[model samples]
Target: MLGKTASDNRVFVYEVAGVRQNTDNDKNSYPFRSSSSVFIKVPYQRMNDEMRRITRMGGTILSIKPWTSNNGSGEQSNDGD
Candidate 1:
């Protein structure tokens, strides 16, 4: 029962709504919806960087939660791969 806790190294999933591919700066371009919920497995250390990147891209994070496995067993682990 001795292992790294969920908070030790967590991955968050950013549920971003209204994500457009093209920006308004584009000349006479029609922006398209990229995805409804972009599941980005961001590492604990890169959370800020990812948030910045998402904001820069005009994405509004609707919700953020720790990444989990499909079966809801526990936090998903990235074994350097």
Candidate 2:
């Protein structure tokens, strides 16, 4: 299970399956600042489906990265978002 914390201190869980850098930096500065790692967050249940899609698209699943908040306790409320 995942825990929630403050906005800045919140850890984002993502999968670094594959990445494509934007080389068209000359067109805009957005590409340069955004041309690092790609983090996509999906629900836990959808992980399997996402993995299948990535594999089908010829991308390799690197690893499952889970980030836990430092200040967050191991308690999460399921009151619906």
Candidate 3:
């Protein structure tokens, strides 16, 4: 999965295997920031579908981050970057 942060600070996660579309406000219900741009995750299988759905809904993807699993396992944060 891929995660993107919109201008409104709302994060959207997608399967990275879909399409991107452009449509009106017919399927939009949530509030999104005005300066939103679509970010896509490539090198995946069938990512066009997810991209299309997000664009059609009038939302933009900002970034993509690696997915992690937190099953109550204690983890440490490293700030050595």
Best by lDDT: 1
Give the better candidate number (2 or 3) by lDDT: 2
C-alpha positional error of residue 55 in candidate 3 after TM-score superposition, expressed in Å = 0.3
Q: What TM-score does candidate 2 reach?
A: 0.39
lDDT of each: 0.59, 0.44, 0.38
| TM-score, ranked from best to worst | 1, 2, 3
Per-residue CA lDDT of model 1 for 9-40, tens digit only, reads 77676677655555532432333435565555
- In candidate 3, what are the lDDT values of residues 1-81, reduced to their tens digit? 667534323222333222334354334454433332423333233345555555666555554543234322232111111
By summed lDDT, the worst window of 10 consecutive residues in model 3 runs over 72-81
* Residues 1-81 of candidate 2: C-alpha lDDT, one tens digit per residue: 667645434333444444443332244334332323344444555566655644654456555664555524432221122
Model 3 deviation from native, Cα RMSD in Å: 14.2
